[model samples]
Target: MIRTGILNPAVLSLLARVRHTNTVVVADRGFPLWPQIETVDLSLVDDVPTVRQVLDAILPQYVIGRIFAEEEFRQVNSPSVVEALRDHTGAIPLVFEPHVEFKRRVPHAIGLIRTGDSTPYANLILESA
Candidate 1:
């Protein structure tokens, strides 16, 4: 009967469980899987649904306090890609660290959503407000 907003049941369930300061990861298609953390694989094809595309769907429903990403994202991806992501993030503070440190934070996230984005280092961890 529900016909609007986030329609994916798995994604809705995952968002429902998030609390203040809890983290949720939106990773690219190539991001490594963590057996210990729950994941919703939304990947349809290579670059079919980008990480930004998923974020667009979740941003209105989720309260993101901060975003964490790899410093290398800006270095590896085009300037337009970086700017596009920044525009989507709006006022949310974005912090960048080394790739290793970024991965270390993944296990603590409430859940991860894997996207079909092929962009290198396109992964991001959003901490709930």
Candidate 2:
């Protein structure tokens, strides 16, 4: 039995298979479910386990090379949510693209983690290092 690090079996299994340069998305509640991509739905309730909460849990287990977000994230999401993401990311560079373009890239990610955050455009794409 696993004693520590991402307790969710599905999440752990997905992360275990992630390779360098692979993409994983940690997205908000409203993010579309792509039929072609594997999705790990973690949303229990509105804002129950937020994007930041999941990111904090996953950050230690993965070596992330870069992060991608919707260009409107700053203007649409709460300041606290944005700040929390920035704090967790630290030195990792954040690359922003239009929401349409961001969604276009989701199908290519190895996995998409759906969080309970209600904030608008609170999605993030992490590239494994």
lDDT of each: 0.95, 0.89
Worst 10 residues of 1 by lDDT: 1-10
RMSD, candidate 2, Å: 1.2
lDDT of 2: 0.89
Candidate 1, which segments miss by more than 4 Å at Cα? none
Question: What TM-score does prediction 2 earn?
Answer: 0.93
Task: Candidate 1: give the clashing pairs.
Answer: none
Give RMSD to native, each candidate: 0.7, 1.2
- TM-score of decoy 1: 0.98
